[model samples]
Target: MKSGTRHPTGYWAEEFMRPHQAFLAEGYQVDIATPQGRQPVVDELSLSLGYNDNDQKSVDDQRAYIAGVAALKAPLVLGKVNAADYDAVFVVGGHGPMQDLAVDPDIGNLANAILSNPKKVFSAVCHGPASLLSIFDKDGNWLFKGRKLTGFSNAEETQATFAGERVAEPDATGVPDRI
Candidate 1:
C-alpha cells in the first residue's frame, strides 16, 4: 500500500516491501494501493540506505521492491480501488502518510471495507500505520477496537527525520482527531 506517491523507503516501507517479495515468491499476488492511487515516492532521507546500499541482502530484498515498483511505473491509486477483491491489505509508510493517507475519505472507506471482510488481513507499518485514521465503522469508531495493533511511535518519528516531522494541525488536513 502507498499514499501520496507512496515512496518506497523508511523502516515501514522496507518492512512491507520485503514481505511483499516473500508473498510474491510464495505465489501470493499482491497489489499496491495508495490514496489518489497515484505513483508513490520514497523518502530519500531514510538513513538505512547510507550504510546498507551495497549489502547484498539489503540490496536484493529491499531495493528490489523499490525497483520492482519502479518497473511497474505506476501504482493502483487507492482512490479508485475496490477492496472487496483482495484478501489482505497493507499500507506502507513514509513521511507521506501523515501528509495524505490520514485524511482521504476513500482510505477510511477502504480500511472499513477491508477490515469488515472477515478473511481479509490488514496491516501497516511505521507512519504507514497512520492509515488507521480511515478505519472506522458507521458509528465512527475504529474497526480494530479491542484488537491488538501497532503504529508509528512518537520516538520513531523523532528518529526518522532530522527535524521532527511537523505535521500540520489535524484540522488543516481534515483527518480525524487521532491521526
Candidate 2:
C-alpha cells in the first residue's frame, strides 16, 4: 500500500459485527469511532467465501450488516471522544488498526483515561490490540507494563503474509515483554 496503490482493508467483519450484535442484545448504546472520523471500510478478505465457510449468504449478511449501522457512517474521531462519556472502549481489529489506532497518540490518551478508572473497560481483539502499544504515561512509561495481553500472533501474521495479505510491523518498544 505504500506505492500510492491502496489495497482495501479495515475492520474484520465478524470480529466487529459479532461484538456489536452482543452489545445491542444487551441494550447497550454502541458508538463507533475511528482515528479520523471517516466511515470504516470492511476488510474485503474477511468477507470472502473462504473466510465465510463458503457461504455466500453469510458474506452478504455481513455486508448488509455493516452498511446498516448509522453510527459507523459518521463515527466519532478518536481525539474528539471523551473517555469519561463511555463505560467501555472496544477497539475492532483488522489490518487497518496496525496503521491507524496503533500509532495515534489520542489512542494512548484515551486508553490511559479509561484504564485509570476501575469502572471503565478497555478491550480489543486481533490487530485491535496493536493499539495497546500506544498507551503510555505522562513520564512516557508503558501503562500496560506487567499486564497479560494477547493480540494477533506471530504465527497468524506469518500465515497471512504467506496468503498475500500486507501486514505492517508496528513499533513495540513501549509494550511489555509479556505481550
**Who wins the lDDT comparison?**
2
Model 1 lDDT tens row, 1-179: 21224334433446556677788899988777666656666555543556467465774565566766652356677778788788888776676765587667788888888878788987776677767766678977666555655666656555644323354233433333543
lDDT at residue 73 of model 1 (Cα atoms): 55
**What is the lDDT of every predicted structure here?**
0.64, 0.82
TM-scores across all candidates?
0.71, 0.86
Task: List clash counts for every candidate, in order.
Answer: 11, 0
Candidate 2, which ten residues in sequence have the lowest lDDT sum? 162-171
| Clashing residue pairs for model 2 | none
Per-residue alpha-carbon lDDT of model 2 for 122-178, expressed as tens digits? 999888998887889888977766677777876787777522244343236546332
Task: Report the error of model 1 at residue 162, Å.
Answer: 5.5
